[model samples]
Target chain A: MDILRLIIAGSVDNGKSTLMGRLLYDSKSVMQDQLEAMEKHSRSQAAGCPDLALLTDGLRAEREQGITIDVAYKYFSTTRRKFILADAPGHVQYTRNMVTGCSNSDLAVIMVDARHGLVEQTNRHTLIASMLGVPHLVVAINKMDLVDYAQERFEQITSEFSKLTQGYTFQTLTFIPMCALQGDNVVQPSTHMPWYQGPTLLRFLEQVEVRRHTNLSEARFPVQYVIRQQTSPDYRGYAGKIISGSYRKGDVVRVLPVGMESVISAVEVGGQKVEEACAPRSVVLRLADSVEVKRGDVIVKPDSLPTTTQELEVMLCWLDNKPLLSGNNYLLQLNSSVVQARVGQVAYRVNVTTLRQEPAPEHVAQNDVVKTTLHTDSPLPHDAYTCLRENGGAILIDKTNLATVGACMIQ
Target chain B: MGTHTLDYLEELESEAIHILREVAGQCERPALLFSGGKDSIVLVHLALKAFRPGTFPFPLLHIDTGHNFQETLDFRDQLVERIGERLIVRHVEDTIQAKALTEPSGRFASRNTLQIHTLLDAIQEFSLDACIGGARRDEEKARAKERVFSVRDAAGQWNPNLQRPELWSTYNGRVQKGQHVRVFPISNWTELDVWEYIQREGIEVPALYFAHEREVVEQQGQLMATSGLFPQGAAAAIRRRVRYRTIGDMTCTAAVPSEAATVAAVIQELLATRVSERGATRLDDQLSEAAMEDRKLKGYF
Candidate 1:
């Protein structure tokens, strides 16, 4: 089954976990024993109702504070689809966790309360989702039941959200009024939501054209492992997963910055010869003849090869307690390749909620997103992160603390 | 899944194979952490599949808890024999006897936590830089934060806040000496994916995961199987129609009431069941929210 990697985001207590729990419960994904346990715990805590929010909110700190502290992953499946739901904490203090959850999501469901209309956190999440290049966005206006299940109330909230998020670029943008507490327009279509003609949240997820998100422009394979026979003579081959595009046997490809073109002699995996490989699948690619290919060596179509640059201008999301100092060398990771990159130019810092750029500061603080320049020791072969989402981005780690201080989307 | 899509099942396999290769090429002296469980069984398959015809680049290492299901031990040995690969086992009981660790206090106490001491000691002993695990992200909340090439300090502690940004297919496997990496090749895979792949590839798994009759004690919601050494009171009783959710020390790992004798039925039940694989059986995780986090920090890959 094709597992849909979905990120659930909304302001605190906007029913993010409740909605997820409802989905799991109604779908029969939660088992009899687990449900019994949840119910038992529920009866011990509250009155009659089992708080579905208890499902993803696993931490005791969260239970005490009644808020999600970290990103909790919940798995549930329908015969039609498997869902990898990453439920992230929405507190501003934990925005870093939220960013991590939305990083690789296929779709982001930003919930809005019908009563509250639009909040700052909702905008921040929507902005982050769009900025991360997540193709689909669903504005789930939850708690329609609170507003007497009014269709007009749903439209008002939807219209208000649209005015602000209109500039956001997304392949699929939808609005579904739901009540996670009451199971309306969540799993089954709500009779109350007859005015809403669109498919329910689950159906929309199943029908969303994921094919449009796949990039088939050209093949880009980053070598993760180099295989060699341990028992025999130096039997060497470069092994890695294909990030994007495809490669087949006998296809001529370039060995990146070395620019040595060679034909793929074999795609040997498990002693069997495979015809080709595509994005995200790891495979061993054999060259017709031996070449000096090792770890971090990228393989791509010679014609569509990304430019190798020493100076990188990227949008950085600073995530650390200490400020980023100029000229400090950090571990720069792009794909499977890791190289030492020095802080070159500290461009103006961009506000998280607003895209407005301010004058460059001497020190970049925690949770600050800045557009900066990176000068690497070696030429980094990659495209603008926007074009090749995979190759174009890099995460900078503080070599000292070993914390991922910043993530960059190469412009 | 799509014309452009790699088969959903095959996609996970390819991703795993890619990661295994990455470890071999990047780390100086890496080892595959084989537990002989279906997850690790799948790992062995992926590693073998990763480097076909040619022998695997790295050695296989097992942290023998001493307390284990005999079926698992048999399968582990059988797998090593079949693949003709070297395996280095460092015993938890031996580690405890060596004064490196201490035995826990109660009937619920398991050597699962003590596996870390042996694992870390083994790493230092072998001078292995990267330890490959079959830990899937979907297994736990803390694991959900894992990077494919997770770097650990000299103490083998994981700092999630400092995880390397894994973008697209690029995995940065570079790490400092003494600061080895913990690579989870199957980080994205779910329990169902493992079963489907096992069925498709016809990979051999320990028979314990399948339905079987066994002696057990239901304590704190986990069906504890009688390992004979624990010396349980009359509370422990034998039961039938049981399958192991996860293969670990027979004492800590629970057996769910399952009739899913075949892999397909297991997959079907897993799809329908709401209790997660670990939630159903993992005794160690029930200890605390930071349980896995603490062990991971200690470099228990």
Candidate 2:
């Protein structure tokens, strides 16, 4: 079965966790003991029904504060597919956590409270999902029970979200009306709203086509480790996951940034020889010639080499509490490559609420997305994030504290 | 057909290999935490696929609780010998004798908690910058919140509140002096996934994982294996065909009555089992709701 990595984003009280819990509960994925524990905890708190939100709020602080603090991942599987759900907090301060969830997700389930319709947090999350190039989106119009499960209210919210979708570029957008608390269109179809005809959220997730969003036409392999036989002096192999495209025996490839070319001698997966290797599979490739490949070096098809440059223009999401200052040095880590980089200039900061570009912000503050230029100490092989996410996406770490400061996408 | 769709097991294997490679590339000195359990066995296999032709860049470290099943120890030795890799074993008894740690004594007394001291000591003794473990997030609640590259302080303590943001697959493996990182390559995998991968790969696991006739005693609603370490008089012993879902200390690792002698049968049994692996087998986790989280904060792996 295919594994779908999805993220659930919504403001506080929109029932993102409840929606997830409903999926697991109705699908019979939640174990009996865990359900018993949740029920007991809910009764102790005098909740009318088993508090589904308590299932995803695992942390003690989150339970006490009744808010999600960081990204919490939950897993479940159906007969057709498996899911890795990332529950991200909706508070504006925790946007970085949402980004962390979106980084590996193929789809974003942005929940909107039917009463509030389209809110600021909804727009911000949609924008971030668009920026991260999440292929699919499911706008869950949650808490329909509170809005009396009215078809007109769902339609109003759906049309408002449709207007907002114009600002984002999601390959597929879907709208589902559900009450996560009462188990409406979330898992079982809502009998309360017979006017609406659509698949349940669970059915949609199982049927959604989670395409492998990699550039299979352009081969890009970043050598992570070199394996050399201790006994056999002639054995040499380069180990890495193919980020894009494929490699076959005798296929001519080039070691990037160093500008050396070689032929693929052999490909091995799980210690056995394979005729071909494709994107996202970890394999060890033996080059025909010893071309001096290192851990951070990228190998690609020689005919379609990426641009090698010392200067990079990137759109960065500042994650650290420390504001970004121009001319301050940080470490830019892309794939396995780490280089000393300094911010050259801040071109513009995105006002996520208004979707406006504020020109030349004084300092990039926490949770601010800014377009900036950076100068690295050494030249590196890279492509724009739009061209190749595996090779283009990066993270900036503080030189002193070593905390992840920013998420970068090469422009 | 020239399609590139990977099965669930294949996808999990690819993700694990990627994580292993990242740890090898980033850390200065790393070691694999092997326990001869099925999970760590899979980890060793992935490591071999990750860097073989060559020996692994790091050694294998095992914190011997001194209360282990002889079968597990023998399996560890044989596997290490077959792979031709270095193995380092540290004993919890050493710390107990040194007066650095006091073993818990009770009806349910086991040296499981004391393994943390031995593990931390081993890390410091070997000066390891990173230690790769085979922990899966689906195993526990706290584990579900753990980052793949979990950073620990000088005291080897885990602060769930203050973890660094891990965006995409880019892990911040930087650590200061006396600090180290714990990398879990199989964090995304589930128990069924592990069993399926083991079956698909035809990997050899310990004999204890399969059903066998063994002398066991009923304690606290769990079937504890009665052996040389535990006399039959400790509890009422009976012969039963059983297998272990997880392998830790013999005192803490319980057995489930099953006739699943083969991997395929074991998979079939697991598909019908309701309780989690730890919930059914581990005796220590029954103490409280936050048992795993509390143990993790105190530096237990």
Candidate 3:
């Protein structure tokens, strides 16, 4: 069966949860007890009827405070496909949550309040989705019932969102006008908005192409473990998850930095012998002969291998409260390797709203997207994160506190 | 890739095997949390494929709730015996008896939350720095924000806001002296993938997973099984057809009416089904807005 992973985003009180709950409810994905609980919780709040958004706003503080704290996952299936919706919070403070929600997401289903059109939070979420490089987008103009489900109003919001999303790398942008509270354009075909002939949210979600690659080539295997047995003292193996490419017994592979070459004598993991292993696969390799490989060294094919370097240019989205300090050292982790790194230079910063690049800042604030250079203690095998993120991305940690403060993609 | 090779699922299996190897290699003392559930069973099979031809570098651990289904216990024992690996089983009731836990009462009572105590105790007992669980992100809303290598505080609590973002395959398993990491290799796999993988690999699962006739009753609009401990309410016993959406404490777990009698049929049912597995069956989550999160903070698995 086909499976799709999409991220749902909207401003505070824009019915993000309501839209999600509507989709789930209309799709018949909600169980009887859950529906009853939601109804009970909703009426107790004295808001007339229970909010369908309560289904996903599960954080007690979020429930009590009436705001989404972080991203919540919702699972449902249509007759044709299985859908995993990553519902992200809209508050600017929780932009990091939205980033985390959208990281591996295949599509972005952004919602706009029919009454308010596009607001600051809408721009923030849409920008965050674009910055995370989400491939597909659907701007659901919600609350159409309040606006009379008019085609003119729907077109107004769609153009506004489209005007802001002009220069980006999205595959397709769909606009569906509907009132989530009234069940229009969510699951069923909206009778009120006949001018809008596009598929409903469920139909659009079912049809969205969600092809993602794991980069199963070039064969980067960093040694996370070194194996030795008392029975076979001479036998040694390097174990790690494959970042890219395929590896098999008899294939000649190179161990990084030390530059030792060897043939794969055997490929064994969890006691089963396999002929080969590829990207995203975790396995152990036995060399044709003994090799001195440790936890930090990487093994890869001699050809199509990555460039090893001490310095890198990165597109970074700072995710911490303390901001960026150039003098401070942070531990950089990419794949199975970890090294000491420093922010060498903040080349420039970009304005998410205007899509304009400005001169380098002295330091970055929270939610600032910047281009910077980093220097590492050791050479890192690198690829452009946009091209092959599994091998090309890294997280910067506050060395003293061990807090992951920033995420960087190799440029 | 072999001819007639499985496409994405096989690739996913290979990826999981690689993660298993990394866990074994990177951590000094690593253990797999075997529940005898389909996910854990699949994990064991993947583990066997990960460290073949020698004794695995790690041991297998099961945090027994003592309220476990007898079939699951039997399957657990049989699998452990067949694998010939060291199996460490810790009991929650043992902790209750030790005064380490104050048991809950009423229909709301569950050792499900108590498994955390036994689990953390076992982790300390074995000095295991890495404990692998079969938790998938799709199971609930709170689990979605989880890191593949989730770090727990000394108190064994997960802070949703304090997670290290795992953008790529880069996983950080580092923690302080008393703190440990809970690694989930199958964090990305959905319910469908798990079922499809099980069916594809012909992996052995508990008999309860398939179609089985059992006395049940409708409680709170859910079909509660009538077992030794959990009383079947006065609802009629018309056994139309059914299967379990989730397997948990028999006292609270619910089942659904399904004609799916085989693995392939079950997969088809899952594909055609609109509601989530937990959505259809979980009674415990119906209690609070952040039920899963609260339980997780209290060290629920």
Each prediction's fraction of true contacts recovered = 0.47, 0.59, 0.42
Candidate closest to the true structure, highest lDDT: 2
How would you encode candidate 2's per-residue C-alpha lDDT over A198-306 as one tens digit per residue?
A: 8989999999987673456778898888887755457888999888888899999989778888999899986789988787789999998977889888889977888
Question: What does DockQ give for each predicted structure?
Answer: 0.45, 0.62, 0.35
Tell me how far candidate 1 lies from the true structure as C-alpha RMSD in angstroms: 3.2
What ranges in model 1 sit over 4 Å off? A36-44, A58-70, A93-95, A230-235, B100-102, B141-153, B157-177, B214-225, B235-241, B269-276, B279-301
Report the lDDT tens digits of candidate 3 across residue range A1-411: 555778888754888888888887788777665666677767456455557877775566455556444455677777677676777666645566777777768888888888899877777778877777788888988888888877788888888888888876687988988888878888888888878888988888887766454344557777776766556455566667666677889988898867889888888755567887655566778888667778878888888677789999998888787889876789988766788998887888877655678897887987788998999988887777667656777888887667677888787
Better of 2 and 3 by DockQ: 2
Q: Candidate 2 docking category? A: medium
Q: What is the TM-score of chain A alone in each candidate?
A: 0.93, 0.95, 0.86
Query: How well docked is model 3, in DockQ terms?
Result: 0.35
Task: Count clashes in each candidate, considering only residues at least 3 apart in sequence or on different chains.
Answer: 16, 0, 24
Sort all candidates by DockQ, best to worst.
2, 1, 3
Q: Residue A65 error for model 2, in Å?
A: 10
Give the top-scoring candidate (DockQ).
Answer: 2
Off by over 4 Å in 2: A43-49, A61-69, A230-233, B1-3, B227-235
